[model samples]
Target: MTNSPAGHTPNVVLITGTSSGIGLHAAIAAAQAGHTVVATMRNLEGTRALLDAADAAGVTLDIRRLDVTEAQSVTEVVAGIVGRYGRLDAVVNNAGSGHLGTIENETIDQVRAVMEVNFFGVVGVTRAALPHLRTSHGRLITVTSVGGVIGQPFNEAYCAAKFAVEGFMESLAPVVRSAGVSVTVVEPGAVATSFVANVGFDPTAPAAVGDPYAAGLAAYLARAGSSFASAQTAESAGSVVAALLDGDVPPFRVQTSDAARQFVGVKLADLDGSAVQRLTSGWIA
Candidate 1:
């Protein structure tokens, strides 16, 4: 589908996991930018608060239920949007979870849980939405983490999942370019979201490690919490999304927070050596 000027706006946008955090903010920000918004979540009822916030801001959103892990649900939601909107301008794969754990101490299920929601879920949603996006030559954006590029201590599973997301999106970008579809992955540093507070901690919550490691865990938790507290807000992330959407050409990777940008530079600089061993040496056995 060729781009049409609907009141001078470029396209309609559909975002997943819009109940809170960057997903919620991005939906509202895009709507404010005059793009039609489809703000979807696992449960529409859980997004009543978001609906109220949008109402207060006088921005309208087409809220729907979208469980990205379920193929049927993804297909239904994308079909509904395309049927109603005639074209899709962009789709943001923003639904994901965080995990903090040592690999040995963490259960297989714990790691699988993160992958299901963060990697496979995104793959399902993006695949389902590709047809509509192809029709419009739209953009596919995913909100990944800095861990995706650089692994961190005690975040083995989370880092793995983000790495998978980055790889998947990166590989998909070239294939879709011929269809005029663009893919951009946003790598954010710790952000002030309920995610950290709700992060699954190695299947044992805060009490996962026994005695000596438990003390280290506590210290790590303190630093992690502080880092997230001092990190960028959801509004700032939304602004970054808005900027990417408005850009003439989409970037393959967009780092939002200053911390993420710095970390990216450090990570890129270490590409030639044993960076993985250097970063994970102290933590991993």
Candidate 2:
């Protein structure tokens, strides 16, 4: 956090996907913490929720529209922020779409849809902001998922996109260290957000006639539903993300809760696939 050449904290911060959930809360938290937060979302029409939340939180944000999937949009937004503040100190890669389906049951385009927003979208934004971050010796934080470390059933596309982010960022951290841009990926387990509902999984809808994955899907959904029922709150998770912006340079990887830490720890310590396989298989059993 104090690694910045500008000061002990990031002066100007930009976050994507502020339309709702983690992005919305993180923007507010950062602003409340005294950072000039630029809250950006893919759609301008969806600003009411965030605007109202900011009003309630007693913090003001420089709101803007930014679609991470578009290269020109990303470049212009980053440029605009730097133009306004003269430098960008931090970026939170929080814009992503959720998908719920296995590869065979889904088309290639569907999988690519997830990747476009979840993975490539991140790459585009990070690329556009790095030069400025390099200038400020700032921070790069991405909100990945526990699924990123251990794949989950019926989340082939979503897990793949998250896994890609994990790999991309892990490789990028060291290379950017000399430039002084600290990188960290925040992994949150089941945060209570519209993200899950938007995944488009109709648990009540019977699987296609005689679908081979019918039973497994049912089991997975039951487990997922229960997990979501006890999911971490978005405000709780966002606070963690914002707090990372200040401490003694956060670790390259972090979990939002003790449960998330334990979930991800399984993969980190597993020499073979057995431990993860055992745990996840039980979810669909």
Candidate 3:
């Protein structure tokens, strides 16, 4: 997809992890909306289905290779896009994975792996894309989970990574605002995708799982899987983020799903003045 011929077409958007789920849907939606879409994955071979969707929609798309973890991959992908397209108008950082286990039992390597993909990978992609984004005065949209804001029993590693991303994006937004780039974090609730199927869990490696906590974690996973089975589809989340990509003065954070709204609202609101005052009374007083 080349830059808008007249610099006044819809816009150009780049989305990550388009092999399946929300990323796949968002790429198709953005293309359908008339944007020049560059969709990337670890390998484009898995995205033939996405290509078919684009074909049916009559939207031209460019799907490419991008491994978010490799600094060279990130740099090369961004450089290739800018060289071919001239500018990048928006980016959706949707590539991520899940880790399930108690923090204590998880190996340091396991924790680092989760953080690499979820947090630092995001940082790498954003850093590589920022120059082009600045050229287009574009927006950066990140997809995070409700786990980022609230604690989920078995997903301590996943939650920690997302929480760190939340803090990172929040802090980076102000620094980039004046450079004509904006940042938004998207919090999605459970959705029925292949996410659970690919979740990383090491059964043999052992730290701490007490019986009660183990029971709760088991129940939570079951409930979550069932809820995902019954919840909205990935397409719903894709549409929301795609729409935000073109909307005016988009919010710094936009949350999707009733479940996400409920969790984020309660958790963030729970950190209000009264609570803070009481908790920090020793220092304040």
Q: Which candidate should be chosen as best, given TM-score against the real structure?
A: 2
> How well is each residue in 124-206 modelled by candidate 1, as lDDT tens digits?
98888888777777788899988998888778788999999999999999999888788899998878877776684443455
Off by over 4 Å in 2: 6-10
Please give, for residues 31-80, the per-residue lDDT of candidate 2 as tens digits: 99999999999999999999999999999999998999999999899999
Kindly report which residue pairs in candidate 1 clash with one another. Answer: 1-135
Residue-level error in angstroms, candidate 2, position 238: 0.2
Runs in model 3 deviating more than 4 A are 1-7, 202-213, 272-285
Q: For candidate 3, lDDT tens digit of each residue in 32-69?
A: 88888889998767888888878888877888998899
Q: For all the candidates, what are their Cα RMSDs to the real structure?
A: 2.9, 1.1, 5.6
CA lDDT, every model vs. true structure: 0.81, 0.92, 0.81
Against the true structure, whose lDDT is highest? 2
Model 1 scores a TM of 0.90
- Rank list by TM-score: 2, 1, 3
TM-score of each: 0.90, 0.98, 0.88
Which 10-residue span in candidate 2 carries the lowest summed lDDT?
A: 1-10
Candidate 3 whole-model C-alpha lDDT, 0 to 1: 0.81
